[model samples]
Target: MRAAVYRRPGPAAEVLEVVELEPPEPGPGQVRVRIVTSGINPTDWKTRAGYAGRMPDGFQVPHHDGAGVVDAVGSGVAGLAAGQRVWLYLAAFDNRYGTAAEYAVVPASRAVPLPDDASDDLGACLGVPALTAAHCLGGNPEALKGQTVLVAGGAGAVGHYAIELAKHAGARVVATVSSDEKRALAEGAGADLVVRYTDADAARRIRDFANHVDRVVEVAIAANLDLDMAVLGSSGTIAVYAAEGELALPVGEFMKANTTLAFVLLYGLSPGQLADAIRWTSGALAVGALSALPVIPYPLEQVAAAHDRAAQGIVGKVVLRIAGN
Candidate 1:
């Protein structure tokens, strides 16, 4: 097996290298996947940079999302067998090996059966961003359904799914974007209303369209706090998944409105929360309710280039073609 290895943390070009390794077999309750597409998320690079200081002792393969076929199933793993097409999430979150290789071994539970209609391109997206999107909208997507929901950074991978999933949950969605192109993308993702973030009357536009939103799925909560605060209805919650810096809330204002501030991370979700996300997200993907972001593909050997493009903030999803079908 050929995999990308990083012995120590540093720049993507400096640290990531493609190397040959003996193919690994699945451990108990795990399955070995013949990787097809390796998805790159911000967390992958962050982990490589030692965001989690206590990393694995040996070489680390860096990717948490991918789509592939089950090459072999380990003992005690049920309902999975060789040749089953699967999509994997959180593959290297706690372990050293991810899908940035020709093969990867992950817990059986992390592999979801990919519907025939769902392309590997789409499967490559479900791990971190889509799951995070589902969790950020709250584990129960239908609870506040039919109410208005606000999504910040509608151009982002997570933001795109937040719009789609919120719409699927029957919420009227208003998405904020920085450009006309992003506005169109959000609108294409089923957002009921799309507003430019720079508009002076952005909050007013959102409030005018939906009156007040019941929930806000915020990507950059710190910078967009004012807008979120202005548009939230009484008893509403701002579910933040990403931010720029420290957050300083208007305590008095939010308190008067009974607003709740909540945060979520894909890697830290509870089992139940993870299950809920998998359930809703998988269903959404099955029915085509979610739209995959445009992808930029690099081969397994070019893993470093993929990381560089991701770190540079490419608008499209960056993926590695680990093995062709």
Candidate 2:
């Protein structure tokens, strides 16, 4: 298998290279997938740059999300057979090889059967961002009836899906965008109101959009904490998926307001949370309630370029067509 191998952490292009590696076989409770598409996410770049921690002793493949056909199943793996289409998540979390290759092995719990009608490219893109959206929005079996939620950076990868899932769960959505062009994109994702976050009075604008926002699906909590606290209703949940900066929170402010904080990291999601996201995403896809994937495609060899483009901001999900789709 030709795989992207990163030996040590540095710039993506400087550290990552294409190398021929042995294809892995499925272990007990795992499945071997011949990958069709691999999704490039911000975490992929961060991990390649060694943000989470030190690199391990061996060469590491990058990417957590992929769609593929099951080529083999390990012992104890039942109800799945060769040639079944599947999408995977949490690939390469702690001990597994990832999806940036011709084949990868992952726990059967991470692989869910893809619908026959779903595109492999789209299925690949759903793992991280879509799961983040669904989980952050309280992926309970019941719907979010009559709740008002706000999505910060709603046109970005995770934010877009947040808007869709929140709306599908019956929440009234207010999305924040940095530019005018993204306003329509957020609105199209079912946001009832879109506020420009670059305005001088952005916090005030957010408060005006929703008189009482019951939840906030926040991307940049470090940058938007004040706005979020200002608009959040009493006892509301602030689900933060990204806090890109190092700004300190005004603990006094949130404490006074009695706001509940849920800091989420997709890779560390609990098993039940992961299962709920899968069920919600699969249901939404089957009903066409979620929009078709908006993707930026790259070749397998150009993974670095894809990472650079994704880091540039404003680009949608980037996917590599690793094999026939």
Cα lDDT tens digits for candidate 1, 199-244: 8999999988988999899988878888998899999999998757
Once model 2 is optimally superposed onto the true structure by TM-score, how far is the C-alpha of residue 228 displaced, in angstroms? 1.6
Relative to the true structure, candidate 2 reaches a TM of 0.93
Q: Would you list the C-alpha lDDT of every candidate in the order shown?
A: 0.88, 0.83
Superposed model 1: Cα runs more than 4 Å off: none
lDDT tens per residue, model 2, 131-221: 9999888886266768888899988878888888877777889999988778878988888989887777776766676687888899888
Alpha-carbon TM-score of each model against the true structure? 0.97, 0.93
> Candidate 1 at residue 7, lDDT?
92
Q: Taking the candidates one at a time, how many backbone clashes does each contain? A: 0, 0
Residue 66 error, candidate 1, Å: 0.5
